[model samples]
Target chain A: MIEEVAVALDVGGTGMKCALVGADGVVRHAERHPTDAGRGPAAVVETILSVAEGLAGKAYADGLTPTALGIVVPGVVDEARGVAVWSANVGFRDVPLRDLAAARLGLPTALGHDVRAGGLAEARLGAGRDTGHVLFVAIGTGIAAAHVVAGRAVTGAHGAAGELGHILVRPDGPVCGCGRPGCLEAVASASAVARRYAELTGTDTGTATTRRTGSASDDGSAAGPGRGRTMVTAAEVAARADAGEEVAAQVWRETVEALADGLATAQALFDVATIVLGGGLAQAGAGLFDPLRAALRDRLTFHREPRLVPAVLGDEAGCLGAALLALDQMETP
Target chain B: MIEEVAVALDVGGTGMKCALVGADGVVRHAERHPTDAGRGPAAVVETILSVAEGLAGKAYADGLTPTALGIVVPGVVDEARGVAVWSANVGFRDVPLRDLAAARLGLPTALGHDVRAGGLAEARLGAGRDTGHVLFVAIGTGIAAAHVVAGRAVTGAHGAAGELGHILVRPDGPVCGCGRPGCLEAVASASAVARRYAELTGTDTGTATTRRTGSASDDGSAAGPGRGRTMVTAAEVAARADAGEEVAAQVWRETVEALADGLATAQALFDVATIVLGGGLAQAGAGLFDPLRAALRDRLTFHREPRLVPAVLGDEAGCLGAALLALDQMETP
Candidate 1:
């Protein structure tokens, strides 16, 4: 008897993580491929299709029947319409990626926003499991959030919900890529931390220099893709902060405060039961969680304090979330 | 044949609006009573019970059958538990008001937060009717909001959702009632407008003075509530701004800017299809709507611009919303 599975993909600017996930969410097969976004969106789309087709073929050859396909990408996704509305990272502009995948794979396909998909996975299978209301915040190159209520993430009217990173936390703070000054992302993101640390250390090489040297592209920037840079990462800054470096500590402290403000704002708005921190910055572990918990608690007044935990699935969350989305479609349909 | 109806009451710190609403949402009868909060929480609870019972009695007398009772109050409410968790306005703390009403009236009773209930009514029956996603912001003494999705208002996990008033819009602006500096309520609420005008004019008598002499009491204590006073109301300030008063224009312009910032943040977060502005400041009509619409549009980037409109239900929204809640309970249960 052939086992039933879903083909899932988490497509980022620099790379894609694909998996053949069984009904129980176990990965039957996993693969990683460079997105080569520098080659343009057309090549990237073709690569995605071929990779998905290969995954399906692999499943069939391995005595597994692929029942559905799920794809998650960075950007605004009109999930209801099965369209990749816009993504700066993948260079998707009004692409009917879901329908294309469904037609190509001859399977039911679901497309979702990368952050939202990860949030769904976390809410259902990771740190926030069993928490009816979960807020998953990804703080990396750029900040984004997903509000999961009763196991379903809210997709705003324009499919632009959870833009927590853009909420203004500082009025006279740094300028965000969105052209606004003092956005939470501009002040608190991991990239922002590295940039601030570099600026304070007088090694200010600008975002372009960092991007050219960094390993990953952020969701906020619309710049061209390049090789991962070999430069100072947010992890190094965290290490320095932990080592009692005054400047690094100051930057980290500011990051925590701004993040607390943003989270407090979210708590005030969504009032979720749990807040799961994901992405790169959350990797700071205790260094990030300790102060963040305290700061968020201090800022709250009458609102119930939520359990703040680090995301457990790490990088696999997106792919798993994509699979979950596909599974949900099957169950609902 | 007897008409079916629900007894609805919108309880506030200063007064209560009670209504007998028919199945079609029409108000069969309406009445108002002073809350007499100075008499304390016990007395207020008694007043609420009396008012609800009176409405039910009135329904029976008028050849109508009261099927259920719905009451909306300010502050954190545990709707699932049918308790008013914490309401500073009505001095309710963990009061099982839902059970009390249900037991007394011998009918199913629903409890809700005032703003959330109002948002529900607006989304389902008022200005936001036909709009699937609606954000209803009430800019009164303090700014508060309700996020209504598909005709249901989101009551946060702790039932403390929609505290839009507390979102920070200005970092170095003013001290909010929540002890936070530069909250939206501190900068743009009706009380904030009056207080700002008072500060700019150097009259500085305080919110109590304005309310004691002004026509309305805002949620904030920055200005006093009473009949349009010598201290000048937010409405008077709008009139002055309309007549080209430089100081008033400057104050009004700042208020609009701050409100726009807050609304833009809300738009980015909720991405709702319609934003219904209610409360006293919204009573400014064109003076508030035109500039607020333009300012919100200017601040938005890629997010869809929501339709900004004045709330049509006026002060009756809370009562209507309460009725809607009861009606909803009847249908869902």
Candidate 2:
């Protein structure tokens, strides 16, 4: 018997990545394109449909038919209603992506938040596999998370269940994009780390600096987009620290402390078995993982200590997660 | 057809309550006794077994042999392991309550945390009826909560999922009984409310105040024994406040604010449809509910507001919930 196939797509603020994933979880064909999200939802939808169509054509040529299509996007999404209630990145309000994609591709389709899709992937086959309760936290351009309980992602009543970034860590610490003061995202996000570094040292090293007297400039050129003026990006800071930069080390220490603070709060609230860290910051490996683990341990006294690990599926996690949802729908239907 | 009856017992820090509950959701016979928990786990277990035996004997004499037994207690209870991992009030440490109850009663048994059991009752037939996700927060001698998803209470991997009272609200706040600073419980529990009132005022209510300030007496002498000179019972504070005492009013305001803060955080994290407040302090009716509602409303900015209501089943909820779990076990087996 031939296995089924689904075309999965993850639409982000910067770009969209699509994959023709088989029942065996292998991506047979893949492609990517800039979202140009500011172009409005319709144009973005067109791009999504065109790329999905291309992937479907490729699958057909490979002697496989796409049984369903799964697409994941950012912002507050109503999975049950198949409506995108709001999307800060894509200028979407109440866009029924599921029905639109189904109409466009003539197949069963599902819509989900990008973070939840990643959580589903981790819950089913990655770090959180088989865990009764798992939290998948993604930190990159911004911080967000998704929860899986009993092997299913919790979409909450309003489709805004996993807004970990908005969780108030500091009631009046820093201003966040959500117009909130002292949110976890405002302090612990990758962008926030870099921004803090720049604010501290009065140098724009693709980052922000804090109120610390230190400098870790491995290379002479600290002047770059978000870097070189003593304020280096979290990446630049990490690199400079790796190359024995003093200022970079200070910034790195603060970043880990902030991440641990946010994560400790998450652990206490959910008390889950595993926490899967994904997105760009996680790519730093030990630079991000080691200090974070130490900080979390120091903070937790009564709550169960959640095992922290990097997300396994890389960039394909969201797409594959969506595919898994579609697969469940197909099998049950 | 004759309805099956189950023997249910609720063990509290001060006393034990037992009932013979019918499958039709009605109590046929009820009784109570002092828990004497400080004597140790063995004595507590004996009291529990004797209570169950008495209830079962009454049911049998009434021409209905109890089908199962349900036991609900406090502290960190591991339901899957059938053990009461630890309970400061019960003097228990890893006591196999389920197995012991089953062995003593000669029937199948189920054990669970008292608050979670009450939450199960509320979710199934009370305030949260028909709600998909419900968080039942009980403010009493100690603070705790239970989450019900799809009419089933979620027991996390370590049975520590709903320790809401321990969530650190202030990093530099008051020291809690759990040895943590600024824990929700340390400031919100019935005892905490009274303790705070005492700390603020120089009068002592003659009772170890529980969270519910509504039951306190006007004069400290009438409250109870074993209370400190500067400590008024939470009940006494509520009583004075009811009579328009300014000091009592201030304490009440702060208590409600802290409860609202904790609830708002829980609302943001869990997004449950309803929150059922139970236990001792919940007995305040409008006094507690009205203020908490207003406070929660003031804090909520971006989350779906869950309906707040007093638990309908009152003290019998835990017994009924335990019965339901036992029945579930029987049916599944």
Candidate 3:
């Protein structure tokens, strides 16, 4: 008798990552590939199949046959139907990715939402490893979260659970992509922070990056104002604040304030034991954690102050989560 | 070898109801008495004790000595502490209802929020029976709800999980008792409906008890200013709609619209299998159900249409739910 491995694939907006995981949750082999999603769903599916096959080859070389496969993607996924009902980034609609993968790989397959899968990874093995109730929030391009209760991620009745981003904050602030106004996403998302800073400084800054402010200079400090106008992103704002930039300091304060407000509302509702912060903005480290914690403490009165910690497993979380789903499917059936 | 009965009491703003529930979930005896809450927490506690004794005495005469007691009251409660933290109606603040009852009745005791208890009863033996995820909403003089997941009510980390009424619906509409503007309670509650209609008509018709339309003589049908001015409570409003009152028809339409908006928000966030309607306003029967369904259908596009049903066990639900909590306490210790 031979023990078989499970292949986990995570497809994001930019790239695809795959890993071969054993029954004991060890990643025996891992690989990454560019998604090039602008070529559409067909190309993306092809890339997924190729990457999965590549991972399977590696596992076979290691003298193992993959028993099952798990794939996680962004957007509205109909997990029961094994279809990605709609996806904005990958240009997919009603694509039966599960059936395609199962047939191509000759293994049982499962599909899920990327953020939810990542949250599942965190709940099972990351920052919220021992927590019974956990909420994993990804604060990158836009804010989104997934709720994991008692080791199970609630997919919701209509498959739209843990959409903390759309929870309205100001009720009359900026309009959101979902056509809602003043959503938490509109205020606290990393993209929102960058947009707000760019709007304030009136500069078309390149990709936002962090830099130390160095001293308490009013106009500019270590990172001099390029073209008499210092343009900065969320990361830069946080870095400069740590280094003592007055303008960056103010922007950082506002960003933390908005983030706290949104997190407080989430606290009042879910009362999750731990809130694992992930995605781009969280990379700011204590620059993000410190003020965010202070803001939450200031806003919360009677609600539980959840332990806010950075997510473990990073970009590979979604892939691991998807693998877990596939493993569970094989065992249950 | 005989099972002992327990005294279950539901303390509302206006009255207190008692029932002797056997271990098998049967109500062996039932009684009601005025709460007279204005007399303060001391008086209310005394009333609850006296009523429990009466119910216990009846159970004893029937060869079943009560072994435990359960009491449910309105407002914020610290169940772990066995204290009624705050209840404006009963004027109780940090009052140890469970300890008081246990000492008085010489039995194990349980105390809980009134609406949450009702929700538990619904989940176990009423409309939400067999449903793992249920949201029990009580739209009465004030509005509140309880989320029942896996047949257990979620008390939240701060004991304020089911405060659905406090969710802001309108950003600048009417003011709510919680000092917020345009809360779900202020917009969709039964009291809000009557108050709104009264404000428009400026007639304190003293609890609109009947629904009436204009004479049917005009153009072979009821058509006039009074056709839409149904002089009735929500119950009478339903009756008038049944009897073809044009005025009551308008009022009923507004009620459904408001409720549907609120419920739609709940549906999007909770994604529960069923939403059980309870409390005083729920007495409208089909008046509430028919229009609410239509309104929900119109508003929802990607959400599950929750199965809406009337809460069974009526007012006794709270007591039974409290008993369930008591049973949990007994089993755990």
Q: Which number leads on lDDT?
A: 1
Alpha-carbon lDDT, every model: 0.84, 0.75, 0.71
lDDT of 1 by residue, B78-188 (tens): 888998888776788899999998988898999998888888898889999999999998888777899999889999888888888888789788877777777888788
Clashing pairs in 3: B208-B233, B227-B247, B228-B247, B229-B247
**Candidate 1 residue-wise lDDT, A1-333, digit = tens:** 779999999999888999999999899999999998878888888999999999999999999999999999987888889888888767888999999989898999999988888999999999999988999998878888889999888989978888888788897988777777778887887778877877898875665321211112133222222424334567788889999999989989999999999999898889999999988888889998999999999888767899999999888888999999998899994
Sort every candidate by lDDT, greatest first: 1, 2, 3
For A30-54, candidate 2 gives per-residue lDDT tens digits of 8888899878889988998899888
Task: Give each prediction's root-mean-square deviation over alpha carbons.
Answer: 3.4, 5.5, 9.5
* B144-166: candidate 2 lDDT, tens digit per residue: 88888887787776776777777
Error of 2 at B226 (Å): 6.8
In model 2, state the lDDT of residue B270: 77
True contact recovery of candidate 2: 0.33
Q: What is the interface RMSD of each candidate, in Å?
A: 4.1, 5.6, 7.8
lDDT of 2: 0.75
Instruction: Please give the C-alpha DockQ score of model 1.
Output: 0.55
TM-score value, chain A, candidate 2: 0.89
TM-score of chain B of each: 0.94, 0.89, 0.86
Worst 10 residues of 3 chain B by lDDT: B213-222
